[model samples]
Target: MVYRLLKYVVLGPLLRLLWPTKVTGTENIPAEGGAIIASNHLAVADSFFMPVYVPRRVTFPAKQEYFTTPGLKGRLQKWFFTASGQFPIDRSGASAAQAALDTGVRLLAEGRLLGIYPEGTRSPDGRLYKGKTGVARIALEAQVPVIPVAMIGTDRVNPIGSKMWWPRRLEIRFGEPLDFSRYAGLAGDRFVERSIADEIMYALMELSGQEYVDVYAAKAKEELGEAVPLHGRAGEVGAARAGTAPSRVPESRAG
Candidate 1:
């Protein structure tokens, strides 16, 4: 309906002419069936380019505020996001994260392509950040494949806090599906979840060529605050390997 209209008749065509993305590895996407496209969140543009290029419609768990805000502008936003296939999930309270995971699992059960940002939010400084384990939980619980996606050079088109987008050559790369069937029944195990999350992040690092930071993007934003610019700053730490989460990260899935 609206999703098709926007992707084909309206927004999609405009994006193609304006940005002209160099997307590759789309063949990696499964021809049919439920899967998770776990991506590195570089900018808001990452959200647009990732789904528009993929063949299937993508459903994402947008923040509740995007739907619940007041005024006419908010109403249009709610309509647009809903029409574009986004659903609202409360990102507050203790169970907030779980709610999102549950929603993702439900979508997967319905055989929809669920797009998730393992880092939870956009990269505050263009470097990959520590990923939350929710993506692992969703993949294992739903028993589906997780494909790692990387959006490159998007920051140049629309940097954080910038009100405008400019035409820039951007690349979107997709890696082969990451199978976690080896740890099938261990979904709730904290170590297994963290291990899986780290593995996905590792794939993004390789595909995106961005440095990896041990800190979460939200925390990094708070810690650095106004002192650091939102884009172009180097990662505070070098690449963190699949099994090498920082001290705060739980132990690996190994016995």
Candidate 2:
């Protein structure tokens, strides 16, 4: 299969040789069965390095644009994404978030490992940001555990707005799987969902040892610009002044 060929023969070996990644707490990953790997997105390479380091095949929902380009390069991009276990996600319309949640639920129901960046977008300044509740909704709906993964030093490999990649030693630490069965049927409760998302983000913060920002990463990028302040409190106040609140689960029904 193309997946195996790419992982074992081509990309995998190349990544290992270039980055020489060090992974710890991998035993936290289930040998088999469905689970969610919730990670703090640091750089574009986070996605690439994650699948390369994780033993099991991990799939993440990618924007449809990654598959819809109109040339030979686009075709190669589509092939690479597919072989790497990524699937196209149409993130448009009012139900875009729900659509992604539905896809994640389906993947988990089929016993596949789903990779999610709870922050929804990469941190503009390498700090942990508030997580969206969609991750909690999918985990509860699929009745699976959420594993916290932290990718360290990936930002140096591929920083924001940079097309070139630099070889750097990357560290991936997998935390113990978080079980939220206590809120099993309460996915509809906004408070409970926020709590679940907060819990996951907290775990990521501890694992990654990055400063935690209460506002969403995209908002921080937009309002605070790429040079996010080093002080967490200042950034939070600026985001608050900019009218950015913590992310919540979409009210739309998970299809």
* Model 2 lDDT-worst window of ten: 241-250
Q: What global local distance difference test value does model 2 have?
A: 0.83
Q: lDDT per prediction?
A: 0.84, 0.83
Deviation in Å, model 2, residue 193 alpha carbon: 0.6
Model 1 agreement with the true structure over 169-216: per-residue lDDT tens digits: 989999999888888889898878888888898888889887778777
My TM-score estimates for the predictions, one after another, are 0.91, 0.89
Misplaced by over 4 Å in model 2 are 226-255
State in Å the error of residue 123, model 2: 0.7
Instruction: Give the clashing residue pairs of candidate 2, or none.
Output: none
